[model samples]
Target: MHPSLTIRRENGDMVKDMPRVKLALVIDDSRVVRKVARRILEDLDFEVAEAGDGAEGLAWCRTEMPDAVLLDWNMPVMDGLEFLQRLRQEPGGDAPRVVFCSVENDLDRVRSALDAGADEYIMKPFDGDIVASKLTLAGVL
Candidate 1:
C-alpha cells in the first residue's frame, strides 16, 4: 500500500492541515518506467509530472521548478547526461534535486552523472522503497 501525504518537520512534529504538496518530475522514455516513478512520487505526497524525453523534460523545467526530478540516463532527443549538463546551467535548475534512474550502473557513467550534477543515481529495476529512500536522502521525501 502507499503512504499518506502528511508531512512532518525535521523536529518530528506533524505539519498542520493541508500541507503544501511537493512537485516531482519524472523524465523517462519508457512509459512503464514513468508510470512507476509517478506512482511512487505520488505516494510520497508529491504532485507529479512526466516527460517522454530529455527535450520535453527540459521544457517542463522552464515553467515550474519541481522539488525533485527522476531522470533517465538515455532518451530519444536529449540524453540524461546532456540534459544534466544543460540543466545545471539554467536559472533555478540547480535548486531541484535530480535523481538519475538508469541502467548505467558502471562506475564511470555513475561518476560522470554525479560530476555533471545528478544528486543521486539508481540502477534499473528499482522498487518504491529505493525510490523513497533516495528522495529522503535528497531531502525530497
Candidate 2:
C-alpha cells in the first residue's frame, strides 16, 4: 500500500465512532478544476481525493473505494467515457457512483455519458452550491 494512503474501518463497538466520511474522488487533468471540486465536497464534509487523469483515478478507485466520483470528460490517458465504461464492468458493491463534469454540453455527449453509466452530469465553471445540489440529486449528499 502507498504510504500516503490510509483506510480506516468503522468499528461497531467503538463509543465515539466517527461517521465514515463520504469519500469523493475528483478526476480531472486540470489542477484548478480538481481544487475547486475538492473545495466544494470538503465544504459538504466529504473527504476528497484527486487524480490527474482517468488512469490514476481508476487505480485509486480500486484501492480507495470512495463513495462517489466526479469525473472529467476530457483527459489524457483515458477519458471519462472510457473510465465510466470500464468501471461499470468491475465486480463489487464498492463501485462508486460517478458524475461527469465537463465543458461538453451537447446532447450527444450528455446522452453518451448517461449511456456509459454516469449517474449525473455537471457543466464546467460550476459553483459550490451547484455541485452540492447535483450531489443531492444523485443521492450522494
Candidate 3:
C-alpha cells in the first residue's frame, strides 16, 4: 500500500493526507513496451510520461524532473547508460530514483548501471509485481 504523510495545516491542525502521486518517466523505443509500462505505473498511482528515446527522456527531465525514471537500456538516439550518465550530471538529476528496466542481463552491464547511479534494476518482460518490487527497493514506492 502507498504511504501517507501527516501534514500540519496553516492553523496548526494536523491531518493525514495521501502523498502526491509520483511522476514516473518511461523511456523506450517500443510503443508497446511504453504502453505496458504506462499501465503498470498508473496502476501503482504514479503519473506517467513517455519518451521514445534517451534523448527525449533527458529533454523532459531538463524541463520537469520526475520522481522516478523507468529506463530502457537500448534505443536509437541514446542508450540508457549514456542517458543515466548525462542525467546525473544535470542539476537536480540526482534527486530522481533511477531503475534500469531492460533486457540486457550481462553482469558487467548491471554493475556499470549501478555504478552509474541507478538505484535499482529490473529485467525486461516485467510484470506488475516485479515493477512494484523494484520500485519499492529503489525507495520510490
lDDT of each: 0.84, 0.81, 0.88
lDDT of 1 by residue, 24-74 (tens): 889999999988888888788887778899889999888777789999988
lDDT of 2 by residue, 1-141 (tens): 132445332232322233566788899999999988878888898777888988898888777677789999999999988888877776652358788999999989999898778888998879988898888887888
- State residue 24's C-alpha deviation in candidate 3, in Å: 0.2
Residue-level lDDT tens digits of model 3 in 33-138: 9999989998998877789999999998987788899999999999999999999999998999999999999989899999999999988889999999999999
Error (Å) of candidate 1 at residue 33 is 0.5
Better of 2 and 3 by lDDT: 3
> In candidate 2, which residue ranges exceed 4 Å CA deviation?
1-18
Compare the candidates by lDDT and give the number of the best one.
3
> For all candidates, what are the clash counts?
0, 0, 0
Off by over 4 Å in 3: 1-19
Model 3: residue 6 alpha-carbon error in angstroms: 25
Task: After the best TM-score superposition of candidate 2, give how far the Cα of residue 114 lies from its true spot, in angstroms.
Answer: 0.7
- State residue 19's C-alpha deviation in candidate 2, in Å: 3.8
